[model samples]
Target: MPNARISLPKAKLSAVLGHLAKIPASLSMTTIQTSPDGLWLYQSGHGLDVQLCFPEARTESRVTTSVNTAALAQMVSVAPGEAVEVEVGPSGLKFGTGGYRASLNGLIVDYDEPPIEAEGGVVVPIAELGRAIRCVRHAVGGVNRPHFRGVQLEFSPGNLRAVASDGYRLARYDLGVDGPLNGKAMLPLKPLDAALGILSTQDGAATLQLHGGRLAVIGEAVRLALTPMGQGLPNVENAIPKSYVAEAIVDPRALIQAIRRVSLLSPQDNRRIDLSFSEQRLEVRGAGDYGEGRDEVPLDTYRGEPLALSLNAVYLYDALSCIEGMARIKISDPRSPIAVEALEDARYLGVIAPILNP
Candidate 1:
């Protein structure tokens, strides 16, 4: 005899698993809880934590059962039809639909934990959230520095700004909106991704709840929260130069294309491309063991002194890719970092360190 049985829509269950899977697999058991509210799948380990709730899942009574996460994920992925029926019994757990039965062993035990307190969070617009996460994702740190691996978010009553740096390059996005939170917080990619991924399934999902050193994305049907990576957070603002002279305004598409075409003849080892700006035209030069190449692009405007600087072609290309229509290339000197700004959208910014060549 089973203690309880519940039928969950296949689509809903699979969606919940998709979010839970983002949590790094750990020996810490993945458990599901049943109560009057709904079914909650909980998993946490290695500085990442996530909780997903299915408010629609029916339950006969209250119970928390440790489950084989891999088995459950596989079953949900291949399970057929609109709904799948699951039962908890003394011998094991059973799954099937329409009279078919697939019995899988389960660990039945008493588990107790308080629900994620999802209250008193500020409403962050979905557009701002997307912009902040996407721009920073491309520029986060490598394994060289653990602190560089996360992005810092500063919230004020007027706007929200997010910045990320990978030592070589940095990116930031600013959006104007009314936000309740104040002060700056450093959040690792794990929790941000989990929040964004789970939010995609929900309609009209807004607000991020920060409680107990964890950040959560709350939605109508499902909610997820993960721990923030707060230690040794990099000081990014000081590294970004405050003053830059706009040297040239150019179309990003043409510039990116010119770099690709000119780098073909350059060596594969460095991929270092030199930029020489004068008058209304800019020259891109690349040299490698194979040979050398140069291409010229027309600039909309030019200012400051005649400028010549070198940088990795890949880095500049990525920085330019994020800009909108017209991009201003600003530089203070050959020894300083370069700034790429989107004239159309002042909210986005990118900085790349110049490669000093003798």
Candidate 2:
């Protein structure tokens, strides 16, 4: 028998959706099995029987059918109780749910065009897309803020770039793609993420078109369109001065592991990691109710004057892990912001602001 999936109406819809978020977004192949009891979605990688947990409600409905993971992701914005019309096709499947729909003429858009273009078009690897998208998604504001907590995507034909900062932690990743778009724009994390949820399941390189502030992703069997937030993102190049140049070399994972261990002792709300430079050594310190713990990491070589600066451990950890290489890191000053460059290569660059109180 062919496998199928059913969408059951829920009493507590938010809870149901939250649970779904934990499931891998790329598991697009699912079977909706309906039996005497109710409905069950059978898919690889998920263990144990799945049950719908719902509170009291007036009415609920479940639709049992097979759906591509990308098709299910398109319904992310649709509210419960809303009707989702589904139909199958030979080339690609079509469905209307949540924030997306199929046109009356039967035109299905899995991909939208980009606002601008590069020479040959930008081709990004699936794993790179997943890592960069995941890091920045957490920094995007759940609720809209005036100009902060948004994601800035920049392409220069030579590099595909993404950055997200919420005035607390800033995350950025730059990787080589087919085309690094010279143009840039800001898009809310939610929609870009929805697009990635569709991409994560596919293999090979993905093509992107950035035009009119809209991004379209062309994949093997799926296409994704994401409307940019449209507010002009700050000129990231000028957000911090280019002259705050000081250099220190360290391992990406070493710093990450050290901070992760120390952060366990730091308060979540007021987490602080202090860095002090002594000769060629870097000292990391953090304090909490359990007192303070300190760890020293050796630096490859230090340039300029020694300094002590305190930063949010969580933010530094987040930034360091994003970059690849056990190499040098450049800093302007303890008071000024920090910029990270990959020593092994120049695939991407990262910048972060210093915490005032940390």
Candidate 3:
């Protein structure tokens, strides 16, 4: 009967749409639902589902429609700092920004409210929390295993832990929180990646709510709802060794550089890097069909029996990149899992399964 219209600042709308752009095209969830109150976008595929919402003041006209998500995101990205005016009428939806204006065809879909469990969710500081997630996300496994494709978040009194493993390497990060929290959830990678990207652009704190098989991340400019993995994560905590026969404390940056040089000779497939520790130094060696490389760095402290282990060079780099200052490597034997610790921050830990035949 009447045209419905709403206005939004270009920067805010672009940020929200940028998150939606991360969602791949899907037959069921590619459309963005718009209403008098705000905008909505949902994407579901494989075993993961994600929903993003941007709420604003309600307009008098109760118009509702769905538009292509990519189209809207592209339009807003090119017009930064300008105001956007959206009008929905019988013909289609009109998008106007600055001197540019265009019309997009719309579809009508049944809009069901997303189930959000905000009760008793822990509040986490955005800056540190976002950094922690980014550091560990690289270790998450591929889509073949749904359970390993997500990050395990454990919330306890005064602390929040993030853990991820790809069977070969595991990453753990710990952050302090105010008050108490008691819950654990496996968050899918897609939504977690989007949430991290959104949080990077904003300030202040974000709330994490996990209930009823859903995880909701409420931020300043956006809200995200994600489906938790149905299966349980592997018992990684038990795999960490309680005692070590060999320990070496060395500078993380120096070790990282040495590993990078040796990795140049690593095979493309396995990318093996051999680590040898003695009383005086730590030697990193890599050999492949093409060539061989080796580099040794002095260790601040070394004790116990001599130990050597072979592992994926990239995995070691990924684990070390997250740490600062001195890093301690504890080993029971060449066959057992090696524990990597940041001496400065006891809250951070990494484990890499050694290569058996190497």
Candidate 4:
């Protein structure tokens, strides 16, 4: 008996077919039946399946890949379609007239090279995108917090932003896009990291599409898609205090190196590093089991009050590291969080939570 199959639009159906062709033999592929609103990729003991659903016939195409067979079985089964025409090539896998059809672990996988969508969306320079992704990904929360462990991307006309924070520290970067796009999504750390690596190897611009919880980056010859993380990112921008007076400008690497040397002696309880700025001297010192080590860096100018205060050694280092140039750090008081700002090439701001001393 011929397997029963449903009809999917040419554009979407082609995408699903192409994805299967790209799967490596390390993974298996099998034919799937189309369900009422989606298609399922199924396997046997491996019990893995890729379920792709079309919520609205007009919605952007979506592809879901999974290795969980138990979860795949629960998904509704549908009639199978005849082997559609597909093709394989050396540059990369392609599908259409001729392609391989197989099942891996229980899920149908494709190596289809779907036709690239129309251009004229949001485009970001590969270098800028690569830098922003790498810088922010470092600050993402660890895997322990599945929800907050990704970089948040926000896009608007002429602006693109990426931010990451692991509660202890935060980092952000901004880029100027070629056109307009109003959308936001969270890209998982691992995939975002991979994308950065991919962008670094390529040149020119990459068009990014953030529709239907899907992120697609189209470079010169490569097209990549990732499912957006459906979790809330903390509002870090609003956390900055409105008023802060004490400001210190110094070298970022110098500040980081000083913290690293001093941290060796500072007690964990008193992760405190005291800052003394008066006349033409600026000093950062930490006290602990190893006694104390201080680095006094000369200042070009000092406008704030001569002040001494304690701060978390890590937070200060984190904010300083994010700044690309010499940093101007502001201190409000003995108990207020520190504000770190750099040259205004881009409107970037970061505030560290203060450690209150009893």
Name the best candidate (by lDDT): 3
For candidate 3, report its TM-score: 0.84
> lDDT of each structure?
0.75, 0.57, 0.76, 0.59
Summing lDDT over every window of 10 consecutive residues in candidate 4, give the lowest-scoring window: 86-95
The alpha-carbon lDDT assigned to residue 253 of candidate 3 equals 96
Q: After superposition, how far is residue 214 of candidate 2 from its true place, in Å?
A: 2.4
In model 4, state the lDDT of residue 198: 39
Q: TM-score for every candidate vs. truth?
A: 0.83, 0.62, 0.84, 0.66
Best by TM-score: 3
- Deviating ranges (above 4 Å) for candidate 2: 1-121, 135-146, 156-159, 168-170, 176-182, 211-213
Residue 248, model 3: lDDT of 94
Ranking of predictions according to TM-score: 3, 1, 4, 2
TM-score of 2: 0.62
Model 3 Cα lDDT, one tens digit per residue, 156-195: 8888889898887888888777545677788878767766
Across residues 56-112, which tens digit of lDDT does each residue of candidate 2 receive? 211223334445543344353353345444333323334445555552212222322
lDDT per residue as tens, model 1, 1-358: 2366777888867875676666666563567777677777777765655566677776767766777776777777676788888876544467878766687666776667655566766666665677677776678886777787877776777787888888888898886666567766677777677666666656664666667777666666555666667663556677678886647899999999999988886667667889998888999998887788889999999998888998889888888887768998888888899888897888888898888866
Model 2 residue 285 CA deviation (Å) reads 1.0
Q: Could you tell me the lDDT of residue 312 within candidate 2? A: 77
Better of 3 and 4 by lDDT: 3
